[model samples]
Target: MTGIKSIILAGGSGTRLWPLSREMYPKQFLKFGNTSLFQETVLRCLEVSDISEIFVVTNEVQKFFVIGQIKEMGHSIPPENVLIEPEGKNTLPAIFFGMTEIEKKFGNSVVGIFSSDHVLDLTAMETISAAESLASDFLVTFGIVPVFPHTGYGYIKTSEACGPGYRVSEFREKPDFETAEKYIKEGCLWNSGMFLFETGLFFEEVQKYAPSIFTSFENGGDINEIYANVEKVSIDYGIMEKSDRVAVVILEQKWSDLGNFAAIYDEFEKDSVGNVVYECDPLLLNSDGNLVYSKCGKIVSLIDVKDMVIVDTSDALLICPKSSSQKVKEIVTELKDRGDERAYMGQTVYRPWGSYTLLEVSPEHKIKNITVLPDHKLSLQLHYHRSEHWVIVKGMACVEVNGQQFFLRPGESTFIRAGERHRLSNPGKVPLEIIEVQLGELVDEADIVRFDDVYGRN
Candidate 1:
């Protein structure tokens, strides 16, 4: 446990738990009880061993969410350890990047790769430690004891037990209902897709099993180049399913991948009427087995719907049946095809400094409520197409315009002219809230000309 390093793969964008989890912010950054799934995974990694190091791999859009949650979790991991992937090449590349860094810093330590969106029973994970410790010459993979015939997950067949772990006999792809039911009866384990490995062994297997990925690393794991050549293959296809040196550790743990509406509906507490309501004021007249979430703390009423999801956010409202929840991604794809921001972002867009919620937007103007954390500063930027007027309403805000700096108190207002290099900073300890109004002939967010950004935006 002393030399164990953890790599939490936090780069999932297709997770369809929308309204709460979108393409920009997936389930990894979502708060379950108080802590997010990613934060809980990091904490669990700590408990598994005295984690020597931790690395999180995610894209730029998700970077702000990851950074904010990690900061809020109050871990000892340094800022430099958060690896930002310029572009995503699926799980294999992300895990390989972390493995590459671990090999650089601490050589040949046992590394555990955990998916940030899983709910695992910690007690069984303790058994995983023992299994990994005793595993010989194999990539140790944790397989959940299948409680039901799930066709969504792959299955692992093990022939013989080899000490604490079993040698993986074969890997089965997602099967039909009958095939899934037969696999469960034939003692096949649900491929948990979680793996633990000795760093050296894992890399050796990667070289032998996935030469494409290994060769991609030859160019210093340049993510853009990796994405250019690499096929859209998951780690299962890239390594585990093909690698001969693979072993399975059976985990009799309560685990679930909250990936879809059905899985989410199964996890919540339901009432006598069979409805899972997250909102306090949700009036469910006859809704049975429905999952409703109100992101803006507004009351929602489900009159006569059955087996549906009613998720109301400040910017979007999704009302669909459980059977149609999977089609929500199609809607997202259509939105992206139409170049709509609704596909990737919410009204409250997160930034490195803080967040800005779009209160209104029009052809010639837009209004936003910007919140800046203490000591946080916006970019030294200028809008070529619009002038912005800022009014502070919460805390003291320090503003800069045309080389002139001034402190603004609550109830005070200032205007930044177009093409003027200006910046905003929160000087107070509390959050600085400002009402920002933009005006121009053709105001557009794309006209921003940032001279400098601390968060490394171009």
Candidate 2:
């Protein structure tokens, strides 16, 4: 049996699902239910391959999230197998990076490539296995049979049947509503952005169509430099469209890219009035179709509103018509152009040790609720422009400041002056929670100077 491995491409910033999905934390890491979409992808891949055989490709910023999520699942990827890209070139480069590593480890094996942010039905594993088995000479891609004429997705025109799959006649770009309906009438499939192929054959096709990309990897140069220099193009554009040996297996399972609030509404459970609410109790009177997501647990009351998307975070609130939800990216673009911190600053930021939630921020002071996992410690670090006061809220915290070590229980407090080296560790069996208050002239992540870090964040 040829060894099969799954390469999960999880580096996308997913700007389309903004506010909820920030640049630092993307949509794949967002929790729709108890688990995130990335965790679901991990579970899906495990059905087809072992944890050791699974390789994940992510950017440097997202590397810790990937590690934390995998650890939460009680599985581990070999540190070397978690290929980190210095920069996200696009899917082709990211997939190529993971595929190259898999080839080196298990030559010419069957590889299943999956996007980390898609919501898939139960038959995903079976469909992927079918695609992999049929990918001897052809690059196999999974195509979803469109339930409706969706103009948001690219369409795949299926030609003559080739074994269990169909030859991809042409790849159509995102069309207008009229063209989308026409494609649906003519039996087109939505490109699922999933692929299965043999290592050697896939590279051969890549060499033929995308010669520069193949040569960059073939020459054995610095991987990051190669990615930096290569054209930032998707795999569908770079190779799948041009390659003669391309096939798409029709997937008979529910699937959604969840590109917008409207799409997200479809995956969630709805009330009698067709309103979907998340994390908050929402009362809808005369409201027909509304999607509400509030992380702050504020009671949302809607009146006489239909087809609306209401997302309320701690720092931001978005209310827009569901029809124009796709234009939310424009807001993200505007925020980035204006250099607004809300565009990229997530309410809860995850670190290697655990995570922290931003409680408040003002001119002279900042507050955070920090949670450190059991047996984990932050870096031995100091700030140049700020001093920190830590109040233990839960569990036991082993604090170190200027070579002095002491344990602080709940309701206990400690202060570290500016330029003083300190470390906070959770010595207890449970999670350590602390309220951190910073008082200073300037306070931000850039002020930190780490002398020693267990996770190597210097």
Query: Each candidate: what lDDT?
Result: 0.81, 0.89
lDDT of 1 by residue, 206-286 (tens): 888788888878665455766677655578888888888788888887888776777778888899988888855887786
Q: Which stretches of candidate 1 lie over 4 Å from their true place?
A: 49-52, 134-136, 219-227
Show the colliding residue pairs in model 2: none
lDDT of 1 at 248: 87
Worst 10 residues of 2 by lDDT: 122-131
- Candidate 2 lDDT by residue in tens digits, 170-246: 99999999999999999999999999989899999988989888887887778877876776778999999999899
lDDT score for residue 291 of model 1: 85
Residue 283 CA error for candidate 1 (Å)?
1.4
RMSD of each: 2.0, 1.2
